[model samples]
Target: MKRPLLKIGELANLANVSQDTLRFYEKHGLMRPSARSEAGYRLYSAQDLQRIRFILSAKEVGFTLKEIEELLALEVTRDEKSCQDVKSLVDEKLATVTQRIHELQRIKKSLQSLSDACCGGDEPATHCTILEALSDHDAGSSLVGGKHHDLIK
Candidate 1:
């Protein structure tokens, strides 16, 4: 039996992505239509739909387009070593996310300290400690791992 092919718009609706997104994926070499109709419309197969879903899932987890391309290549190979390589890629992403979390935590602490320093008064901006701290060169250093121990005081 012959497999069914879906038009570009149909596939986009099934995938819940814009038709332009599908075209972008094609341009990036991440996806390809199974065939083109006589009317020049792009047509995709069930396999293409599966590939697109995989790409979207990878992107949701912070994989770059380039990385998704690598993953697609790896998926085709389907060996034990390929599985190991995929694990390594996920590990690298996890480490990056972990580092970003730490940096954000530090920023949150700094912002909280700055907020606590403010008296919340509606009087005038001239006497606002928050504004003063923001203008301080030393306070700016806190964003780059510099000491902010005295920021609250």
Candidate 2:
């Protein structure tokens, strides 16, 4: 026999989320309890716990709630086309992460150059090369050999 449905508190404890967060998920259409008790308490199944775990996992992987919703929708359909769609979304996310990594690398190198320029011998702030580079309009262009906007944006 299957386990009986769990009330909100029980599900929250099992799922490791607060009852308010569960209600928030429900309000946001991310999830809903499987049923309600006669006294109007929310009730959930084991499947709901699984769904909450999936939601948390997706979030940890940097998926936006909107993206997670799309993933969940695709999962519910469980069709070949949906699998292809989900793969495409994953590819897009990977590309975005790659681009962000590249951007961060550029920023790191630029900041490193500024740090290198500073002698760090208790020089006055006015004479600090790091501060000078930050204040100067053409700093990144000279230090990193990239345009200012390239380093920052």
lDDT of each: 0.77, 0.74
Among all candidates shown, the one with the greatest TM-score: 2
How far residue 101's Cα lies from its native spot in candidate 2, in Å, is 11
The lowest-lDDT stretch of 10 consecutive residues in candidate 1 is 122-131
Off by over 4 Å in 1: 75-153
Best by lDDT: 1
Tens-digit lDDT track for model 2 on 47-114? 99999999988787577888778767754256876778778876886787786566556656546656
Poorly placed runs, candidate 2 (over 4 Å): 76-87, 90-153
Candidate 1, residues 53-149: lDDT per residue as tens digits? 9999878867799988976775424687677877887678677778767765655655665666556744344324543544453453545545446
Clash list (residue pairs), candidate 1: none
Q: What is the lDDT of residue 28 in candidate 1?
A: 86
State residue 103's C-alpha deviation in candidate 2, in Å: 12
